[model samples]
Each structure stands twice: as C-alpha cells, then as structure tokens.
Target: MTTLKKDSLLKGTLILALAALVARMLGMFQKIPLDYILDAEGQYAFLAANNIYLLLLVIATAGFPSAISKMVSERMETGRYEEAKRIYKASLVFGAVSGLLLSSLLYFLAPMYATDVVKKESITLAVQAIAPALILFPIIAMMRGYFQGRQMMSAGGISQIVEQFARVIIGLGLGILFLSLGYSDTVSAAAVTFGSVFGSIAAFAVMVYYARKLKKQDARLAVHSSAEARAALQPNLPYATNSSMKLKFRAIYSEILKMSIPALITSMTINLVYMFDTSFFISITEQVYTDERATEAFAALGTKAQSLAGIPPILAIALGSSIIPIVAAAFARKDQAEVNKQTSMVLKIVCLTGVPVALFLTASAYSVTGMLFASPTGYETVAMLCAGTILQITMMTSNSILYGMGKQKQTMVNTIIGLIGKIVFSTLCGYYFGVAGFIIGSTICFLIVTLLNLRLIKRDVTLHVMGKKWIPYLGAVVVSAAACWGAEYVMLNITEGIAEKLSYLLTVLVSGSILCAIYGILLLKLNIITAQDVEALPGKLRGPMRKVMRVLRAGQSG
Candidate 1:
C-alpha cells in the first residue's frame, strides 16, 4: 500500500475523498448528458425521481453507516474485538430486514409521491424503476460501514466509486439508445433511473468480495486476541450461540437504534432541506407564477445548480466519514489531545481548501452553469448557493465530529434547530425573490447549525481553529477572489464575442486556471498551507501541491 494510503485517519479520509470526488463527478457528468437527452419536463421528471430516491437512500445508507462505524470503533478500541464483529453482524441483519421493507414501501408509494407531492404523475415510472436498488444497498451500506470501522477504507471507497461508475455508464448508454429509438423522454428518464439497479448490483458484488476477506481477517484477529480481550466479550456470547443470542440481539438492536436514528436524522439534514426546496419551492413559486414557469424554475435551481453545488462538499463529506470512527476510537481511549488535534484540523483544512473553491465557484457560477448545462438559467441562484455552502459544509464537518465524540444528542438537536430555521427562512425568502430566495434562507439555517456546532465543539474539545492562522487563510481567500474578479473583468470584453455556452466554457477554463494558480501561489507564499500539510495529501495530490509550493518558494528566493 502507498504510504499515504495507510490506515491513518488523514490517509483514509484522502482515499475516501478522492473516491467520492470521482463518483460525484461521474454523477454530475451523467446529469449533463441526461439534460441534453431530456427536455425541460423530462429533466424535471428525472430529477424528481432521483431526489425521492436519494432521500430514501439517505434513510438506507446514511445513519447506519456512521453509527456502525462509531460503535464498532468504540468496541474495538476497548479491545472487545469480538463484540465489534457482533455489532457488525447485528447491523447486517437489521439492514437486510430494513432494506427489504423500505424497498417495498418505496415501490408501492412511488406513484403517490411522484403525482401528489412532485405534482408530476409521469415521474412514477422513473421512481419505481430504481426502487429495487434499495433492497440490496442497505446491506451493502452495512458492509461498507463495517469495513470503514475497521479502517479498511479502500474496500468501501472502491465499491462506492464503482457503483457510481456503473450508474453513469449504464444510464448514459441506455438513455442514448432509447433516444435513438425515438422513445419518449419519459422512457429515457426511466432508463436513466434503472441504472441505480445496476449500480447497486455492481456495488453489492464488490462488497461481498471485501466482506469475505474482512471476515477471514476478523477470524485471525479473534485467534490472536488476548485472554483478557476474550473474557471481556465472554459475558455477551456471540449471537451464533443459541443460549443468549436472543437477549444479546435485543440489546444490539436497541444500541443500533440508539445511535443510528439520531445519526440518520443528522445525516438527513442537508437532503431534508433540499427536499423542502423541491416541494416547498414549487408550492411557493406556483402561487407567484404559472405552473409551467414554476416547474421550469425548479428544474434550473433544483437540478442543474444543485448538481454543481454538490461538488464542493466532497472533502467535508470525506472528513465526516473518516473522522467519526477515528474520533470515536480516541474518545473510547479518552485521548483528549488527539480529539483536539483532529477537531482543529477539520476546520483548518476546510478553511484552506473549501474557502477558495467556494469563492471561485461563486465568481464563475455563470461560466460553470453555462459550461455544464449549455444554459445559464439559474446562474445567480447557484452563485449565491455556492457561496452559502461555506456555512453548510463547515456545519457538516462539525456535526460529524460531534457525532464521533458520542454527542449524538447534541448533533440531533443542532440539526433540528437548523431544519426549523431552514423552513422558516426558505419560506420567507421564497416570498421575496422567488425560487432563488430559498437557497438564501437555507444558507441562514446552515449558519445556525454552524454556530451551534462551534459552541458545542468549543465546550467539548477546547478548540480554537481560527486564532493563529486566520489572517493568512483570510488573505489567501481575499486575494484569490479579487484575482477572479480581475479575470472576470478582462474575460467579459473578450468572451462576449463568442457563442453563449462556448464563451462561458472558455471563461471557466481561463478564469479557473488563473484563479487556481493565484490561490496555490498565495497559499504557499503566505504560509496558509505548509509542507507538512502537503505531505499529508494523497500521492497524486501531494506531488502536484509540493511542486506548486516549491516553485513559489524558489521564486521568492530568486
């Protein structure tokens, strides 16, 4: 294994982060082609089905994965390796049963949600076509989470990327074929939706292979476990034993619910807010404009803009995934210093990487939207939305850190507050500016969560991430944002003569290159990112980042 791909938390986070980036980028590219194949109404139907499917997916994969990882990490840290395995087994059984029940519920209830809530009965086929994926994915999620708990991230990371890879390839291929056959856009949407089934199958196969290997590894660990370790778990015999299996399982499920439910609620926070955007924004906009206009607006803001916005959170999501188990293990060992170190690093990395990207995306929102969708329908909304994610992504990182520290209750409370804030803000904002206002309101809600998390984190870990390096970090972001505007000013005069999407595409390429170059140089010259930080990056990124820093340092010396 590569040194940077070792089982350290930072390494694991990098692996998962890169994998998620690939998967999400594939999903994004998948949308670009689907947007071309499907017209306005077709895009709406396609997105509606996927939204419902994704929210339900949050139910399936979100909470249990984090919870399983945390619980298993805690158990293993305490040297109850066997009980850690039991936690995995118990969660598996729960996943199988829950997955089946939820899958059927989704299949049967598709028509109601598509017609009644989304107000588009045509999306029913699209929704129902992907329902079967839920049946197996819950189990797959369980295994992936279990692997993560063991710090074997490559298995889960590769499986998730492969899953999305399959989804994109199948969805695109089938979608193109159906369109060539002169089928309805409705049929194309359904074909795209069916890709989830293939994705789940591919993912399940990968998970099975990894699960088998991990099981063999687990057996070896058990054999080598100390006597004291064995005795600690002896009291709660394996569920395979008939004697106390039933009682032990009762406790196991109870534990699962205890952690998973809150984690589910917390994990669902972002998706739930987006769900509000879909139904709530549509409902609000319909009152203000014609049904067709509202639907068109929804398509722009919800589908195209949101897809682009999803890219920035990749690091936060990866950190959240990798952080919980590592923090939980440290907490289990009562390592306060490690917790503080990790908690501080989370915000530092977010500030270093996330802030600059958010600014660039905001500045070039039109270019990005135009480049991707071949239209800039919701450019303004997306611009502000991308900026607002600075708050949202930070909140997500803190929430995960709190959850890892076994503060599920606090995180749940924070989410609940954010949800309420989001609903109120979106409604009020929608009243003022139409669909664009909703994102503003949700951004406010995210601010609420971020503040709450900061308070709690300060109380718990005694962290002050901003004290020492705040100036350089702020300088890098400010200078880079200014560079973007400067480039924007110049590109405006030049690119106006080019075609619409092509002009914007060129602008994105040129401006993005300039902005990143300035940002990277400033990050090194100002010491916002150090050599150690670059060293911590995965092998692929490490080399490039080091070269940037080296060139900058050498330039300064010369």
Candidate 2:
C-alpha cells in the first residue's frame, strides 16, 4: 500500500479504537446510575439476561463478518471488484435472514434455556424479559460485522454509540420512572431488558441508513460496468434447474455455520470463562450466605467488584484489537523482526498502562467502590477483583499475541487449563470465603494462563518478557500504590458530599497518571523507550514532542 493509503487506514482504525474507548466509558457511566437506580438484585437480573444475549450474539456472528470482510478484501486485492460487490450483497442478505432465524429461536426458547441449561430460577424471569432483545440483537451484530468487514468503521461506530445511548436513555430512564411510581426492582429489570430490544432497533435503523448509502454507492459503481460484466460476476445462480430457494438458504446457512464454528469456539472459549464464573460465583455465594442481606451483597459484589476490576480488561481489549491485525499481517509476511518489535512494544504499552491502574484500584478499592456504589458492602470483593484485573490484562495480551502468531490450538489449551483452574479454585475458595472466592478464582486463573503464555513465548518466540521488564512494572506498581494511598488520605480530609466524591476520583485519576509518567520516564532513563521511541508517535503528536527543546529554551529565558 502507498504511504498515504496506509496512513489513512491507520487513521481510520485509530478513530474506531477511540470510538470504542469512548463508548465503553459511556457504557460504564450508564451502568453506574442503573446500578443505583435498580439496586443489586435488579441489576443482577438485567445483567444476567444480557450476558446470555451477548453469548448468543457472539456465537451466531463470530467469524461471519471477519470471514466476509477477508473474502471481500481478498477479492478486491485480486482486482475482482464486481465479484466482490456480488459477494458483499449476498452476505448482507444472508446475514439478515440468519440473524432473524437465530434470534427467533433463542427468544422463544429463552425460558427453557435459562431454567434447564443455566439452572437458575432467578435467571428465568430476566431471560424472559431479555428475550425480545436477544431476538433483535443478531441482526444488529451482523450489520456491525458487515460494516466492519467493508472497512467502513465510522458507520459501525455511530451504530454502537446510538445503540448504547438508547439503552441508557430508555432503559435507565424508564426504569427510574417506574421505580418512582412504586414498581418493584424485578419489574424494572424486565423493563431494562425490553429497553435493550428498543436499543437494538435504534442501532438497526442507523445501520440501515448506512447500508442504503453503501447500496447507492455500489449502484453508481455498477452503472459504469457493462451488462456482460455484471452477468459474468454473478455466481452460477446456485442450483439453477430444480433446486428450491430453501436449498440455497441452507447452503448459505451451512457456509456461515462452518466458518462460525472455529470463530465460535475461539470466542466462546474466551467468554465462557466469565459466563461460567458468573454462574459459579452466584451459586457458591448463595450456598454460603443464607441471610438475605449477605446474599444480596454477594450478588451485588459481582457487579461492583467486576466494575472496579474492569479497567485493565477494557484497556487490554483496545491494545489486543490493535495488536492482533498488526501481528497477523506480520506473520503473513514472515517478518520476524517486525513481529517481535511490534509484539514487544505492544506488550510493554499494555503493562505500562495496566499495572498502575490495577495498583491504584487495589490500593483504593474501598474508596473507589464507595464512591461509585454508595455502599461498602463488597470492599473486600473489590480488592480481590482489582488483583484479578492485573492478571487478566497480562494473560489476555499474551494469549492474544500467541493466537495472532497462528498458535490457535496452543491458545485454546491455555484457556482450557485456565478455565479448569478457575473452576476448582473458585469452588474451593467459595467454600472457604464465600463470594470473595469468585474474585480469587479469577485472579488464580489469569495467573496460571499468564505463566503458560510466558512459557509459549519463550519456547516459540525467543522473547524475554518476564525479567527486567516485569521488575520495572513492579516498581511502577509500588509507586502507584503509594501515590493512591497518599492521595486518598489527603483528599478525604478536604472534601464532602459530591465534591468529596469528585475529589477522591480526581485523586485516583491523577495518581494513576503520575505513575504512568514516572513509569515512562523510568523506562527511558533505563533505556526502554529512548530518543528514537519519542519520534515514533503519530505525526501530529510527534511534531509537538519535537519542539520540546525550543519550549524549554524559551522557559529558561523567561
């Protein structure tokens, strides 16, 4: 690709990444009030049902979009533009039909699925509440994937924002309105689920607008082509003579299912860890705590604790998504040096970003949870989850890197081992410490997986990611922890009410930022990110950094 083209591509990807980050921020803020608005049990029911819906969406749409995009891009690369257009059109229709069928089946079977397979009585009501949303969600996922495949990320970004915004506005607002009128939490949870359906509908509308625009563009392009060209580009019309349309649909179904299986396995293996943990944690906690207050706290802890520990995982997703394509392309070209450099740099950035955040959370778990949740019922849970966040970030990045390097089977094995470890440890911990055990189990699993990935990296990739680099990371953690603790103490003395809450949050944020700056400088002082590294940021940022010496000179004269 030309430099300009590559730059444009990078810019688009960066924009999408930023959009995802902002959307996540919005999602968290949206959930914060919802958690308060509905209370623990209500939030649990809503999240529980939504989790099932998410799993189904991932399964149904896992590899279809990526595979579709890859196919289209490959066709375009080979100069078969008309054929690519035909493939895109076929994929769109296929996605819509399949999404509809899948959603219908799941929506109808939701109660049975929850009661029989999940075996949760509480989940039954929530599942029924979320059923319609599940039904409509697949179509939205497909549209999202289709756009992503077409490299039209802006449409996907807008759709995501629109979807989440609708969920927050309609779900939270209506639920709060109902609560003010004396609706029970259970009913509010149900309303929240219904809101999800409306949110998906809104996203679908936005997607249709973009899809139609794409269709217009495609039609304009088609007008320039000869009739013979269009005719030649069409597939053999698939089963011309006696074959029914059902056969064609079935063929499309089979194709999507075949590709989706691996992608499903890959996606599920990654997500199942959390889903099973969710069930296991809730079950184990209910067993340990017969008291209603304790049980409620246990259930709520899962949300608040997970929320507290979620920052690293959120940031890791961004790093992982960016790194995967880069690593995949490098592997494709057999460019070992570039692969090694990119992998190492990405890993460092991940650690540099995650460690301090995790440390800050660990140091101020109680204050952080109190600030967000208006209660300290699960402070211990928050701390344990905070530790897990660190392990999760490390393992996710390393395992993702391995997967990108074409070690899918090894990555699968690592996940299986981690899952097994999580189940056993979580069970034991729950027996010993109740709900807190769930977070402990999570931390244990990620630690196991991180070690496994390290072994793989050493044996297969010749990288030393575990020595001096880790030592510095530890130092940064210590620095961040001290900073947060000190900040917490000082902020607590000078603030009250909303200002106190804001002050505590600002302290945490500032503490984390300072630690990152110190970590980066320490790395440079220790020759990690050196003079050359400063020059490698995006052009816009690099220009400002390059003028630092001039600014320093002017400052000295002043």
What digit string (tens of lDDT, one per residue) describes model 1 on residues 311-405?
77877887787788788888889999999888887877887777777888898887788788857777887788889888888998999889788
Q: Lowest summed-lDDT stretch of 10 residues in model 1? A: 235-244
Instruction: Give the whole-model CA lDDT for all candidates, comma-separated.
Output: 0.78, 0.65
Q: Name the Cα RMSD for model 2.
A: 5.6
Clash count for candidate 1 is 0
Worst lDDT 10-window in candidate 2: 235-244
Q: Please provide, for model 2 over 162-185, each residue's C-alpha lDDT reduced to its tens digit, 9 standing for 90 to 100.
A: 777787688777777778889888
